[model samples]
Target: MRLPIVAGWPACTVMNCEADQAGYGEDKCVTHLSEGELGGWLSRLGPEAEIHLARTQLAKGTLDQIKGAVTGQDDVPQFGYLSLRRAEIEGGVDLCYSRFSKEVDLYGLKVSKYLDFEGVQVSGGLDANFIEAPQGVDFYRAKIGGSLNLEGSKVGEQVRVARCDIDGSFLLRGCQVSGNVECYEVKVSGPAYLSNMQVVGDISFRNSSFSDGVQFFYTETSGYFNVSDSEFSGFVEFEGLRIAHDLIWERASFRDDVTFDKADLSGLVQGSCLFYKGVNFIRTIFRSAVIIQACARRVDFWGARFEVGGTLLLRYAMVRMTGAILAGPTSLVAFNRNFVDIFGDPMDEFVIPHEDPNVKLLDMGSVNAGNLTLVDIDLTPCRFAGAFNLDQLRLEGEWNFGTPPSGRVGITPFTWAKRKIIEEERQWRALRSHPLVLRSGWGDPPDNPRDVPGVAALMTTYRQLRKGREDAKDEPGANDFYYGEMEMRRHNQSWGKGERWLLQFYWLLSGYGIRASRAFGWLIISMILTILLMMGFGLPQDSPKQEAAGTVPPGGGKVTFEIDKEDPRNPIGDRFTSKRFERALNVTLNSVVFHSSDQDLTTTGTYIEMASRFSEPVLLGLGILAIRGRLKRGS
Candidate 1:
């Protein structure tokens, strides 16, 4: 028979045969050799010799003869170099417990059934790119010294690389697997490039460890993309990755930064991951819920979009969300795990804390708050500038805002009264440029320039937050925000303007109608001043007397009596008499309630009563307004 031509090796000595010599210096290929010659050729096989099976069809039992020739001590098949490029395996390839000192070249090789490499150890890399495996490929418990490349390969069934320890990079780029790709407990010393891969079934690296990181850029998987319990030591990139189902990463730890930029997930991206560094989800799109219960340093969702009815639960996660966009009706929760998992499911693992794993920073600078719900999350470090539809934002449960400075600051008389104010207001007031702010001991200004919101922006933020609190029937909480809003407006206006002066007076009198004690104190002071003024200059020196005169000539039948009273003069002396003090006290008390007292008074005392009627009543009204604000409930 005319055999196929194999390049880069001596051809078989059989006439018109171009098959490569099976053994070194062999006269014929494996197909052309007789039983006696094949036995002699197999006897000469050693572990140091290269094996070229390229472009040749291997019979069912031929591998048994080849395996026996290369079997070393302990009955393990050993080879220096093995090439099966473009070769067809009739009975499939099973190199179980095989040891290869050099590379294994399976380029363009065709295996009709499963190819087993169970317990195999390869010193050199495996170049199985573009190989055709109709059944499956197994490298279970295999130890590879170099890279395990399967680029552009088509596996009809599952590809098991579980328990594999790879020294070099593990590349499956552009490979298509019709079945599951199992990579459980695998360890990779080099980078793992899984880009452009398409898997019909699940591709898992569960419990795997990657020392040089991994990439899944543009990879599309129909099933779940799970890296649960895996550890990544280097940077990981999953940009443009598409998952038809959920992306689970429960209990996974990432030592380096990770990015999922521009990724599309049809299902949820749920995880209990621990990231020591940062993670980015820039421009990513999620169709379902994103429930990440991770303890990450920072997690950026910049420009990411979510679908409707999706929930973003970050229970027990110490993460900071930056530039995230909640475009749809998304329920966001970042409460403590105990607060969320109150049902006490047995399967839920209790986390041991290095620190409290709760959200510390939430940057809502680029978020759309239209259909977002924030529940029980700390907003002490939250930034809300450039947020859209903030008035429609829903705040549920006890949302915590930035608290004012507690206790007395230094020996100064100024102390920041307790109030829940937004972070922007604190940042603005903490600026060194404002002497009053410094005197109030607002601490340091924000280190980031972007955090310092303008007066107008802070006003808008406070107004929107106040509206949200009012909508939620939290009048007490909204009162603080209202005070902040008015403060911002006052700060924004020029001191010479009437609006600023009016606000200043309002703040001084009643703390924008929220401080009942301050308003009442002002009212008491006004009453005391009025009493002293009335006692000093508002009482007459003596009581005015009336005289009656009758006109008898014009009307004899009726006596016409005219009562004449002299205008009282200003007080000359002894205005502090007991009788004068009683009249002054009576007049001042009536004017406090906008009532006029029927008492005789000097001209100066009359003017004083008119002023008291206007001013004392106003102060009393202000006190009442302050009380109403403190106790007002939502209607």
Candidate 2:
């Protein structure tokens, strides 16, 4: 219910144009009237001084506004406080915003503006539909309250709503714009649904506030967007959008889910698409996914619990969270099956890159979803043909290497990828935790698989492809245990046979014999400890009889006395001359009396017998080796 401007006033006599521009003023001019009827007429006549009336309400639909030409620059029309509410609008609005100085206003009404809203609303719904504003609709400094509904409107001009205040939805559904749209500082209280809208120029929502939602679902645009610092209280959607230019959403905040389901982003995307705490996607795609072209912040996609398809590309992204998951080939099974062309080199046009000026490879970082629900999506082929990027999500769910192949044809890249993912997942826990081969050095790489390198390399390669993970909603945090569970199952696995084999090969060839060295080192340390214990207790130190600390050395107890004379086997000489020797003997005797560990070797007849038996086998084996050596010499 808007206050419509008073019209149908009598016109002045010496007017430049005809009826529509300045018609009969109610007080005089018409069937039996004159401009002189009101002797107190102004010396100069303006647009509002004269007005006309339509004989009847529109039959099909009510006209929202009108558009007409001005005779001259000075001969501008002035429509003060015009209002059209709930008026049925069919064919078009003829004289809506004909001249610049008309104070136009609109309430609940439909309009087709081949006409205009030029300088109309000082601040109101300047409804202009069907008008290809080749020049653009300018609401320069207009204060408008309520929603600006442009549903099914075709705007050829840039829609400039700089510094406007509106309360309702700025519905631009199914609208097509050939120019840029600048909505700087325009505050919207409800959903600004531009769903299914197409824009050929740049679009921006810098410093704008969306109290409800901001929808650009199923829209196509070739222009770059700058929605930095924008706030969306509800879910903001660019779902199924086809973009040919860069999209800069730097510092924008999403309180709910921000979806890019099946969106084809052909250019660069800068800044964070913060996945709100609990958003989920089922089928998304990202082909040749690129993040910030320069400020390579790894967009956090760790919250992604949705299945996506497309070439994932986080070459220079900062992966967020210690719990972040870098999707592998398994994550892109959908894309491999649906969008990728096999049997040759890859296609260039298919890649969607992010090249924001402030973006660099390092920008790809770990996803932070500490206070959120985890999402681990099961990937599929049908999902990739759509526009989904693995780089655009934060998965709190256990990363999975999906379904096994059902047949030979199923053993395609997608299947193999699935296998790799599964295998990697199985070994993830070990790889991330206590790595088997921990030393960093120059060692020969293991023999690779027939199709690719070993499982680890393959998985890493797959991770490399996932470059554009992002998040749209972020609100809550997840508990440690449940959050760990949500992590890709790959991180919870143990090393597999493949991993072991590689480690084993490296150990053998490096000659560092790390495993054996570790074992022997520990063994030596144990022997030293035994000696120290024996000496500490003032007992016979060199005696293995120290409680038989270690399992009988592989060769029983027939350890031949191999000590050099200079390094005497024992201080217990058969005949001692010095009192020191006697004292030592007495002490050794006393210590032996007190120590249970210093077993009397001579009294342990069982050990002697075992030693003799062990000697027999060794002797026999040596005898054969000697005979072999002699035989070789004779030959």
Candidate 3:
């Protein structure tokens, strides 16, 4: 029913309400309408009509009895400006699908029930400062053209802004959410500030996009907080955050720097994200597990601390940074299948697979922990590109590498064949390469002197580790890593020509002091060869004429005297006839054993004897040292 319009007076079309006394317009009216009356009035306005509340306030005084301000679904009501400052909403406020043409000011308002703004389109900014919602607040799928300011608000239940698009800055500083706070799939155009927020339940920003900077400084969350799959185009700061439950940021991308300095996470902190710029986790503490699957660019964990409740896993992560500091005693499991690139140059045409495929590059140079358990890790394939500062590291438990669950697998015949084939292919390719050929491949081979950083790092780490083991009286461990250090030195292409030759010579002679038995083997082979030479040449055929002389000749000659039973020197020994082969064998044995035999040594035999005397003692000494080392290790 249309209301009558009198001269200079107009009433609400449905009700006999007088026009807004503030003289907003004939069509606008401020009434203390019931929910039914308001719903009917809004329904009558239809989609084409614009609700102009300029200079007019539609105040609901007894709204406590109403179930909802707008309950039933009608076409979205178009409002010029929404000003509900200091208004008290006893029940829920559903502004779903509502389109506000201008700014929305709900400052200092209190809602006893849920406050929903689902699918709402606000052309101007949204200001909900100091707003209190006891039930919950939702802005699901809402599109805000201007900034969304919800500073100093307190929500009893969850605050969901899932799938919302805010064209302007989103501010929720000093807000308190009693329940979960979800901002999943939200796209914010400007800076988003949620500093000092207190969320009792989980908080999520999954799949959201923050074009400008985002800050969550000093924010506290009792339950899980996730920003998984979110994209931050600008700087993201989460300094001084306190999370009681797990904090996850799996697959998130940050275009600029992200800082999480001084954060205290009581539960697991998992991140498998990408950071184009630098990232900092300085002084952060994780009470439970802290896993970082992957990250790009610099990542600084200068003073981060982790508790022992769970393992700190850094699987498949690539971090290009100066270093990461581990300051506490914890179990660190760093497994990266993709870490094979560190073993070789990424720009090389051919890359040799790492000694272990499961090797991970851990920059433990800045680690300051006393006791750390490094399990299922192999340092052989690691490329420590910088100074491995282990001066302050006090490794407590067994420094496990090539051991247990993730240890190297025994290669089967088929596996070996496959590897050989691959190696042959690489060798063939290398043979055809020109010295000036550009290295354009995925493998990182050491092509220049600058590429020796990994070798230097390995050398430093191995030396330090060996020293630590030696100090602890772990002879076996020390010896094991001693070989590792030698291997690094041997493979270092940056060594000078003389140094390389010396290393190769040492390896050939004594296997770098580890395989003394090899030297002993060579000594035996030399003795055998000498024996054959002496037998074949017959030891210069000692002159027979010299035997007749009364004086002994300088080149001693064989004395063949007639055997007479009357001769006392001959006695019965002359009855035992020996072959020439026997005589030569005896002489050779005497020469090698450094013993004087009755047979005279000829000039050629003298040379063989002198060579054996020189080499035998050296070989024996090496064997003794090897045995000593083995005994010390066993002990």
- TM-score for each of the candidates: 0.86, 0.42, 0.59
Model 3 Cα displacement at 229 (Å)?
5.5
lDDT of 3 at 184: 92
- Candidate 1 yields a Cα-based lDDT of 0.79
- Please give the lDDT score for candidate 3: 0.61
lDDT of 2 by residue, 7-113 (tens): 55333243432222223233322222333532223223334432232121233222221212222355444444444423333444444234423334333344343
lDDT of 1 by residue, 1-635 (tens): 01122346876777886656786657577877778888888888976557887666778878778888898778889988887877777867998989998888888788788789999999988888888887889999999988888888899889899999999989888889999888999999999999999999988989999999789999999999989879899999999999999998877878899999999999876656767777877888887766655556677777787764466555444344455666567766764553222244322334334555555546777677887787777788778888877888888776788887776766766466567877778777777676763536566777875658799988998899889878877787788889888988998999889999999998888788787777788878877777788888777666777989887775458778999987766687676778767777788889999999977777777888899899878878877876776687878
For model 1, name the residue pairs that clash. Answer: none
Top-down lDDT ranking: 1, 3, 2
Residues forming the 10-long window of minimal summed lDDT in candidate 3: 415-424
TM-score, candidate 1, is: 0.86
Residue 424, candidate 1: how far off, in angstroms? 3.2
The collision pairs in model 3 are 344-444, 345-443, 345-444, 345-445, 346-444
Tens digits of per-residue lDDT for model 3 on 594-627?
Answer: 6655554455556666776676656666666766
Q: What CA RMSD would you report for each candidate? A: 4.9, 18.9, 12.2
Stretches of candidate 1 exceeding 4 Å from the true structure: 1-23, 27-37, 47-49, 54-60, 85-88, 101-103, 315-327, 338-354, 404-418, 430-453, 546-569, 572-583
Candidate 1 lDDT at 425 equals 80
